[model samples]
Target: MPVKIRLQRHGKKGKPFYWIVAADVRAKRDGRYLEKLGVYNPNTNPATIELNLDGAVDWLQNGAQPTDTARAILSYKGAMYKNHLIGGIRKGALTQEQADEKFNAWVAQKEGQVQGKVQSLAEAQAAAEAKAFEAEKAVNEARIAANAPVVEDAVEDAGETPASEEE
Candidate 1:
């Protein structure tokens, strides 16, 4: 049977999520699968992928064809790179240790990049919130000042006050 790697659509119609799976080529998009490889969540600022690296590489080595979207998601998550490294190891151009080292380095760099993006986004949000708070405070202070009550001095009756003697 021809095996294919593809995404099975789930979640709401407008907000979709998917399961990455290994299934018969003829199976329905959301039908039964041989094995689930991962999940993809596209709703995030940066798309999120949770994949089983070893299983993916194994399937690739076994000649399971990946659909276009699945291929892109795998590439984004470095599964393709890992497969290439495995191929290099098989070809004797590189040692397994070397391949592992490269993969680890790449993972570390990717993690750093992702973390940096998240930090920057958080910082921007915080700055915006602070600015809004300050603007609101200023407006409130202005409103209070504008609506301040006026105080007037009371006048005494002319008959009640003692008159000064004329020289």
Candidate 2:
């Protein structure tokens, strides 16, 4: 039986969440999975993905094909790379320790890149909020200045001595 690694949609409309699963290719998109591998949540800024790396690599090595989106997700999470390393190990091109070391180094580098992106995005959002706040503050100060003369005129029209003059 042909097998596939694919996503199954689950969350509410407009806020989509997905489950990564291994299943028969003929199964319905969301039905009859052989294993629940992990999850993907695109609602968050960085588009969160939590995958079972070993499980995914196992499926790949066993001949389960991945859909395009699933392939991208697997690539991002390092399953594809891990599978490649395993293949290298099988072909005597790399020792297990060497393959493991390479995979670990790659994972570390990917994590650093993700962290850097998150930090940059956070900094940009903070700067935008600060700029908006300053503009709003300036507008409020200008409005107060514009209304001051009108307030004084109304006081005089009502024959009430302005508070400053009375004092």
Identify the candidate with maximal TM-score: 2
| Model 2 spans > 4 angstroms off | 152-167
How much lDDT does each candidate structure score?
0.90, 0.95
Please give the distance, in angstroms, between residue 141's alpha carbon in candidate 2 and its true position after superposition. 0.7
The candidate maximizing lDDT is 2
Q: The CA-based lDDT of model 2 is what? A: 0.95
Model 2 residue 126 CA deviation (Å) reads 0.4
> Residue 66: error of model 1 in Å?
1.7
Over the full model, what C-alpha lDDT does candidate 1 score relative to the true structure?
A: 0.90
The digit string of per-residue lDDT tens for model 1 on 88-138 reads 999999999999999999999989999999999899999999999999999
**Clashing residue pairs for model 2:** none
lDDT per residue as tens, model 2, 1-167 = 99999999999978889999999998999899999999999899899999999899999999999999999999999999999999999999999999999999999999999999999999999999999999999999999999998998987877755565787
Off by over 4 Å in 1: 149-167
